[model samples]
Target: MRRTLLALLLALPLAAQAAAPSALKAEDVPSLLKPPAHGVRVLALWSLDCAYCESNLQALLKLQRAHPREIELIAVATDSVAQQDALAQRLHAAGVDALPARAYAEDTPDRINYLLDPDWGGELPRTLIIRADGKRSGISGQLTPDKLATIAP
Candidate 1:
């Protein structure tokens, strides 16, 4: 009974996730939007230690696949480059259309997050929807395809 209860408890958090965005730094943002960009950018803020970040990444991959022309997804790594390498492999395997990603370090995390989203409230895996005309929307958690589509071009 204890084991079952423990398992349920462990799984509860995952079940409660909503399609939201995590906070990231300014230096990392540019990596998500490299040259030849469409002038429209959707930033996916992910941390190396967050499991939900990885799952959300996969969801982003799926969303991109479902809507190729509508939006451009920038998978920003709010983690380390070492971690992002593995993430890059996963992204490649999943076929997510991502540019070379930039990693963030703890030393500068605060400044960066504050710059990106002043009211971040310390969240991981945040997504920022940037329109060509510079309009923006902030999503704080996991992602749903419909929400993704709506934020997309």
Candidate 2:
């Protein structure tokens, strides 16, 4: 029993390490808008202090859940990679840790934001809908049901 307990304890750190989000670099920003061959890509852009970011994430998650094959969720936290642990905790708390997520790893966040959307100006809870047909749209606030509906697969 002691060996089993020790093994479980040792695995805890590994589990936590595996949950950290990937790094989002400036160069990778352009590819984020590329239309996938299948399904809609909902790229959720958020920051730690955004009042409505979590709800927006949850709403997007719900939409993905409702249309698993039709919707793909990519959540990117605009927070620095240095704050990865906090961002991971927030994503886990929001029940979106399983989705593909990344944290900004570059020193110039404005550059990254501009790449994501030239008109965005670094707003929190920004969302981008990329369709399979090379169509895209940007939203700079919390996603409403009407907004969410527009990306339904």
Candidates in order: C-alpha RMSD to true structure:
11.4, 1.6
| lDDT, candidate 2, 89-118, per-residue tens | 898888878788888999988888888888
Which candidate leads the pack in lDDT? 2
TM-score, every prediction: 0.62, 0.91
lDDT of 1 by residue, 1-153 (tens): 999999999986553321112333465555543422454566677765665777776776666666666566667666654454465554554444243344565566676667666777658778877776666678887777666667656
Q: Assess candidate 2 and give its TM-score to the true structure.
A: 0.91
Q: Which stretches of candidate 1 lie above 4 Å from their native place?
A: 1-39, 82-99
Error of 2 at 107 (Å): 1.1
lDDT of 1: 0.61
